[model samples]
Target: MNVTITTIYDELRGFLDDHQVSTNETILEQHSKDESYHTPSLPDIVVFPETPEQVSAIVKVADKYNTPIVPFGIGSSLEGHVIPYDKGISIDFSLMNKVLEVREKDFLVKVQPGVTRNQLNKELKKYGLFFTVDPGADATLGGMAATNASGTTSVKYGVMRDQVRNLEVVLPDGEIMHTGNLAQKSSSGYNLNSLIVGSEGTLGCITELTLRVYGIPEHIAAARAAFPTVDDAVEAVVSILQAGIPIARVELVDEHSITQVNRFSETDYKEKPTLFLEFHGNEQGLNHDIEFTKEIVEDHGCKEVHFEEDNAARNKLWEARHNLAYAYMHLNPGKKHMVTDVCVPITELAGAIKFARKRIEELGLLGGILGHVGDGNYHTSLMIDMDDPEEMKRAAQFNEEIVEYALERGGTCTGEHGVGIGKMKYQQREHGKAFSVMEKIKLALDPNEIMNPNKLVHSKRRSL
Candidate 1:
């Protein structure tokens, strides 16, 4: 390594202990990429910081060297959001993990950025509260906030950005700033919390957060409804939501996905297009919702609807849904996993998914369709053999076609997964003139383009 970069290693060691800084090849490889199929790139060094002050110090040093700073938080992101394409300092936040406080009366919790959603929920269980922005993976809260992640429960509980009430962020120039306060609502200055939540580490580094939580519901019921076709299942979601059932989670898993899930989880779920449903409410209310949902699905051509009466069964049902992607990965051992996230208007969802399914068949690719249909968001989890150039090209074409289709309508290229390297090309097409505004924000906040460069917005410092 060059002398200048080598000096950064020494400076980082000075900020923390010697053990906190790593030039080890294994650690560098681990920090190189996330769960995406995007190509991996290594950072020059990885430094573990335990406090916001330490994070600020690391940022200052990165700024001094004009080096890129990619924040690491378990590296569970699927869009290559944390890859360090421009070899520099990677700030690993695993050591900063801690649940600082749980205010049960206030229904809020203060936690360090490294704390995962599962970890926080575990602690909140003692207080009969739960953090609800579950994006399938046990991803670190910091990473989830960076990506504005959402999954099955987003239809009711909302995304990570919604739960976030405050953030302790370290700016590109090493200044510590709080985006919001603990108040229930705010009409103050700009909604910096919203801006930073989905910034994908381009604007600032989140060191700590104050998040909103919900009390455990008195009654919970989960069910799996089988449909003859994917269209029927998606249409049923629209109907259920339009009926105002307050469904906690409604997911559409296609026949192919169910096959993979059954193979991986060893559960006989009747290999067919199905809708995984859940409702949270009082006993009487939940019963009414379930009955109402059953009527709506039957009207839309549901073949069979089965409810999980026990907690174990309910957990297993959701577990299979959450592990659906891994199921694809497991069954197709040699191929990489790439998912297309597109969300459309509720009315347009059925048609959009139909188009995606058609394209998948036309392209002759190996993949499955899954949707958080309650919110009109779905993903096509594709398995591709990277070595096969023709197959890779077809997969790329499929992604582009579906993304363009979503853009042509009022939908986004990415519903939940942030535009990392994977979806960066679609930004201009999706945002039009407003994409320039995003660029200006990136330039203003990160003039040197040091914070998680080459992922989100592209500035003059780097080309997309």
Candidate 2:
């Protein structure tokens, strides 16, 4: 809008084609917000850069103009991670979508940041290989690494940070930096991989990545167990983990979520608290694991337990689980979703889930509880009418209460979703004296405040 910003836009058009650099209102609106319930704000410009060199060129321009940079993926993130509040430039990475290399022998793959999980998996399937980190939605690998995202498979494989071995990052001041080597373990320098993984774009923009992949298991199995109460299902999960059975994925879908899934997925799963479980092993080992898991869940009051060995049945079961969120949205037509992600230690998970349900019922909120329970992380997909002040207030209170509870129990306010604008208020509470250390790192990496400003670090309790 001003002369300085106007000059930067003119120069951007000069370097990139007219189509690559856009000031159109429709494109700006599309890049404005993520899938979160947070209010949307448009960026002044949206640029799609196809190469890391182009990213560097654009970053240099942003530095010259002192403009903000908010990297955009597929907008699948639920934490407002990509909102361009200051109306600077939004760098949409969709154009950089490509898998550069797939090393089947080393179990590694190099890809651009814009490549989605589904896209990468489809390519990897040829060599009997697959990327392990799956966050349900078809989010860009760059965004997933930025958020350190994890979903069902995290229990056995770990999160995005674990899968990432190398990162090609474009810094705030127009410099390119790589995080680490492809070695399985490293003890050399400052461990930049961990630092940048969950930074929520506060430090820099990710341009490329070398990720760890996995071979398809020799044999695979899936199961669904029904519990009479939420507490029972949670307890069963805790027991299974305690027994140290190597379960690949264990998800909790409550009765409310089940009913919603049935409505949208057109499947008749019993409307009860249930655990969708999966195992990865050889045929003999998988059978042994399934039997042991069965014994443990039954001990914790699991009434009905069923297993699926056929590939089609297993895929369908996971598909339904992934579509549960859409079901909730479909049921709540005009309402906005306020999703919560809190993870506690295994010992404290059952109590925490029970408390969350009690509070939700007491507040009379329309919501459902589901999550990757094996890792002690859970989410409450709350649907609320944003226009209703009373409902909004209750949702805020419920979120705060659960966060406080998780913190008191030595848990994190965010399990998978990064501290984009959504969890900024909880940073100091969760990290305490160490939160300032984070601020120092943020400043050291992004001193100009050009990369996704007002996000994870270098700020106190503030709204975006």
Candidate 3:
């Protein structure tokens, strides 16, 4: 480390304890990579901040030294969002994990950034409320909000940007700011909340957040329907959405994914193209919804349909779906995970998925296709040996192909995974001239380009 960098690290100890500030090789190595296929780069130091003030103080020190700062959560992010490429200080948030408040009467909850989705849900259960945005990773809320993540239930509840009511962030210059207020309705000055939510930590470090929650549904019914083909299953989902049935959760799992799930989970799910679905409402209304869903599936030549109302069975069904990616990793040992997701119009979802699958097959790679088809977002989870240049080349090509197809159909390159290093190359193509505006905003918030630099938006002074 240089003299200035050494001085900053030594001064950071004033704000936090020795144990909270780590220069250990192991900790720096751990902060170097996320769950994605991106190569790792070690940081010089890792600082655990217990409060927003501590974060701001740390940022001030880093800014003074002209050093980069990457926010670290649980490291569950799949897009290399937490990787510190500049080899500076990593501001770790794991110590700030606390459910600060539960405003059950107003369906709002305030939490520190490091709290995981599962942890918040466990606390919300007492109030008969639940946080709906589950990216299926038990990810820290800060990481989820940073990526604007969504999962199966997003079709009904909305994505991270929608659920977030407010955020407490530490600006790059060591200033604490709140993006919004407690009141939900605001024709306010500027929508800073939305901007900061998905900036992937390029804008600022999220310290705390107040998010909208939902009451536990009166009734939740889960089901699995096997279709004769992948296209048939996807088309059935489209028909269901068109019919306006409020599905709480609707996920599509291709035959390959099913095979992996069955192999890993040791459950005999039919190894066919299938839709795992759920509904939330009163008993009578939920039954009606289920009947309509069945009719739609049957119309698409569904081979068989099964429903699960029991709590254990229903939880197990969703659990298996959440674990689908892990099953792929289990099946392909000694391989890195390169999962990518894109969202297209509901009308084009079936074709988009078909195109993605075809590309995956032509490349002769082991890949599994699945998605939350209700809102037209899907993922292709691929396992690749990083040492194999050919495999890596094909994976990149497949991602580009799918993203291009989705963009042509009025879709986005990334559904929930933010524009970290993984999706950075597509921002210009996806946003066109408007990306320049984003660059301006990034420059304004982080003039030094210290907060997760080289992420969603590059420093204005830096060329592409």
Best by lDDT: 1
lDDT of 1 by residue, 1-464 (tens): 78988898888877689779998999999999999888899999999999999989999999999999999999989889989988898999999899999999999999999999899999999999999988888999999999999998999999988999999999999999999999999899999999999999999999999999999999999999999887788878878878988999999888888999999999998888899988998999888988898899999898799998589999999999999888999888999998889888877887887888889999999999999888889899999999999999999999999888888889999999989888899888889999999989999889999998888877555675
Ranked by TM-score, top first: 1, 3, 2
TM-score of 3: 0.98
Query: Which is the better candidate, 1 or 2, if ranked by lDDT?
Result: 1
Q: Per-residue lDDT of 250-344 in model 2, one digit per residue for the tens?
A: 99988888888888889988888999999988999888889999998898888899899999999999999987777788878999888999999
RMSD of each: 1.1, 1.5, 1.3
- Residue pairs that clash (backbone atoms under 3 angstroms), model 1: none
**Per-residue error (Å), model 1, residue 412:** 0.2
lDDT of 3: 0.90
lDDT of model number 1 = 0.91
lDDT of 3 by residue, 46-67 (tens): 9998889899899999898889
- TM per candidate comes to 0.98, 0.97, 0.98
Q: Tell me which of candidates 1 and 2 scores higher on TM-score.
A: 1
